[model samples]
Target: MKTQPATTQIGWLGIVLLLFLAACAAPPNSPTPSPVVPTQAPSPTPSPLPSPTPVARSLRLWVGEDAAALPAIQAVITNFTQASGTPITVIPKPPDALRLSVAGLSLSGEAPPDLIWADQEILAGLLADGYLQPVRASGDALPGLQTAATSQSQLWGIPITAQNQLLLLYNRSRISSPPTSSDDLITSSRAAQGGLVMVWDEPYWLVPWLYGFGGSLTAGADGPPSLNTPAMLAALNLFGELAVAAPAEVKTYRGGQRWFGEGEVGLMVDGEWALSEYRSLTETLDLGIAPLPRIPATNQAALPLISGSFLMFARDLSRDDLKPAEELAHYLEQPTTQIELALALGRLPASMEALADPRLQADPGRAAAANQARQAPGLPPTKAARCALFGIDVWLPSLLKGNLDQAETAEAMQAEAEACVTQ
Candidate 1:
């Protein structure tokens, strides 16, 4: 009866709304709802890019093709590269091209090297030609070496190592001990298998004999050649005597090297450049090295030319470029580097500090070289003197062959020297 008393009519919209509200409510017996998770914003990922490579600073170096020098120079360059993160391109140039390369007088149409290796002989020419720039080396450079690098009261380059005077290399198996005088040398050579061998005709070799006789190429550094002087005549006479005693195969420098290397010569006259080659040959042959014998007549030791290699800079280098180049040159001249070079090359060190090293003092060959340097004088490397050397090359054969008289040979040499100076 109560159920039949309902009076209000529900609308269709109200009925649908009541059903939606019932669906939204959770049932009392249902398990607890999971905690509502907050919507999270996603983090974006970045794409990768490549890193750029850095370009290394670089310099060009032209070094002589000397077998002994290359390794030492390359070692120094490698060290410098690693320390400074700079790259250096090393060009092995012919020794003959050293002067031309440094002077920017290239004949092969190649670009001039930024840094060049030159000997003191060519350094003089380079300085006179104005091809070399002044060095900014610390003033603690070796006095003698610094002098070699100087011209017109300015230092032009850094000295590396020095080639001592012409050395007397003999086969110890053939000669028990070194000869003290020219007479002793002649006696020992006469009994030996190959006998004395040298490039006696060349002025470079002739200088030692001339020096032994108290003769010089010139009276002054820039003076005319004194080829016709009495000292010259005496030197010529002594050289002639030695030539008569020596084997005919001792004609050319290369020939002498071959003869000595082959163990065919008993006494050989050579420079520091030949030390390594000689050492190689001595593995099979007994070799000995000593200073050149004294001239019996004059009672003077043979004083050959002492020269050094230099690091020369190009005149066209910009201030920025020049600073690094100079630093490299100075680095090479450092005591540690110089000592290493001297030990490797068997050469006299140009650095005084290197000279005082214990390693150098213990070396017998270097000891002889040091003694020879004390008696030796530097050879003038002027173009005129070089020209005179050419003339001597021409006339020397005739003089040695007995085709020209000694007096005539001297006169011809003097005339050629004068012509070269005047030109």
Candidate 2:
């Protein structure tokens, strides 16, 4: 039985080998099968390319003599850079030097600042020359800016600070009730020794009188220039009276703050900024602030409001450059930054929100000034208004020297200013 089983296993193995050979063998006549090709992977859809990174460029800004304003400006610039990923360089130049530098830059067609933080009056000249780009009068770009600060139906700059020509800084010890009317101011001036010691020969200061007497630099909608009007003549007469009541040296007195702070003057017409300088004069010397006295008959409060603004000069800038500049300007106009600036630099904030700050409201003087600015009648919306208000370089100093009588001075100035407008 064992021998039979072994022989049977060999026969089974041979049978299996024959079946494998049969399976492996194929007919040569069968059409050669095409070689199987690797199926190409479905081509992947290409991804869109990313936007290019913005180029890094340096921006130079010209600012004025406010050391306190520097930190806030820097903070804004730093924040702008962080948010927009750009670089800004702020150059604080002397106020006197800024115009010359800007002029030089324009003349050479090279190296101009990307922005300028300057007095609006100065920007007026630049605007006339087409050196500035119109800010397009967008809503709230300069939230608290008066119509006077803008130009050509557009905002040329973003006003950040403002001051007025007529501020009544009085000595509290001498007078309990501050004068509310021009007649009252006159009466007080005559009663006091050394009188008011008015800071003589400031035309801007004199503008209040012109307004009080119902005169304006420019004509109303239908009227002619009012320089020679009867109201102007009366204002000049009143000013002459005030000038006579003042000290002989009043002509030489540069500012009334010194005279008022020293207790030599009873009443002074100055700006709110004078409070800081005169605060230490006397603890008992009560300091009172009020808007410039109004004309008795007309009941009009006349003030020459001066404002400063932040301007952009990068008309040729790409989006990358413009984004940061716009951001920085926006940062500077923020409520918090405006408050900080008002507190640190004694500047009035350009935003209405900043005006609501408790710190600014604490000081009745600043609060009053802020209120007056908010309500004050703004200058005309023309570059010529600036030249009319603040005569050209030579004319300003000469007029301040008090060489001509009020009539002659006003006439000469009006003519010069008109010429500047025509030119």
Candidate 3:
């Protein structure tokens, strides 16, 4: 070990310190360093949460209901709203005005109804004009409701009520017993002229008489109607005679019910739908429901037109929106709803289960209506059936007002029906 000088050792130490500092410092030509951005592991990208389900929209329904029946209908609707937690607005409309109401729907400053109350004739016409949409309801409808509920392969409406029988309604306070035959009715009506009232303005009212006289609206399902036949002439003349004996004021179904209630009219002809109203309108006046009088001259009972009332979708209702409307219709067709309507409003439920309920089976009023239903002729639904009805309605007013005779009216009706059918 040789002895070293202190200066030499100090220099060596300084050189070692310089090398250590140089190793820590950046090279002169190197790029400037960025601030240390604490390398994040991308925060483990948060998984996306699912979107919530959208709520169903509220629905709107247009009901062609008699005024007195609206409360019962509303009650049924209320139950559905509570169960589904959705709101519904029901609009009451006249049966005759329903078509025109939809015609001006765009101009009415409101959305078209999601559901509409439809019958055989109205349903047929609406389907033809593209005013209705094919619906998702079909099952166990009354026999005559086939055409009204479906269009060949498509379901169009849900049947709620059936057995739309023409009833001979009499105010028992004025007339003790219902006449058994047309001869008896004519005699009674003539003896007390202006005591009877019938909604003769409606063509459906004439259907029973036309059939009773052995006249058909058309030879086949499609027309060229057989309006100018001898049978039609006979039916028309007899209807006219009854009209002559009827009060001019009590011509509408509502009017007849009111007049009968007031004891101003002794007898009236209407449908089973009016039973509840007639019963409600008077406590003093005993309401009687009976089958239409048999035509003595024809030796046949008046053949009533039995049908089912339905819930139909409007054309503007999207297929996507149909589920809610369909649900509402399903609710309406349920046995609970159907039975409630039958019990409250005298409607004959389309549901067989509802129809078989002990309440309905034991109801005397409904029993009489059922008897009339049994007598209804099996009139098929046809494309031209609505047209034929339109023709009659167009020309019947003229015939009743003496603006046209039976022959002229029948010929005019035939022409009108043929034109509509051809179109």
lDDT of each: 0.74, 0.65, 0.76
- Which clashing pairs does model 2 show? none
Model 2 collision count? 0
| Per-residue lDDT value at 81 in model 3 | 89
lDDT of 3 by residue, 60-169 (tens): 78888778878998898899989987678888988888877878877997677888875666777677778887776544555555544555567777877776677887
Off by over 4 Å in 1: 1-59, 66-71, 81-113, 121-125, 136-150, 191-194, 249-265, 282-284, 296-299, 320-326, 361-364
Model 3 Cα displacement at 109 (Å)?
6.5
Which portions of model 2 miss their true places by more than 4 Å?
A: 1-34, 40-52, 55-59, 83-86, 106-110, 137-145, 220-226, 283-285, 318-320, 377-383, 386-413, 416-423
Model 1 C-alpha RMSD to native: 10.6
* Candidate number of the best TM-score: 2
RMSD of each: 10.6, 10.0, 8.1
Question: Per-residue alpha-carbon lDDT of model 1 for 338-405, expressed as tens digits?
Answer: 88888887787777667777888787678777767655666554555566566666677788889888
Over 1-423, each residue of candidate 2 has an lDDT whose tens digit, in order, gives 436688799999999999999999985786789999999989999999998986778788777655766887677667777876767788887766676767687576857778778765556566665767755322242332546545545677766665543578777777776788878888888775436855555566666777677777667422233455577666766777666557655554454556667677778777665677667767544677877777877777655454545554544545556666676667777777667767766767777667778889898777778766664545654646655655423243454456766577666666777666666
Model 3 gets an lDDT of 0.76
In terms of lDDT, the best-performing candidate is: 3
Give the range of the ten consecutive residues with the poorest summed lDDT in model 2. 135-144
Q: Report the poorest 10 consecutive residues by lDDT, candidate 3.
A: 372-381
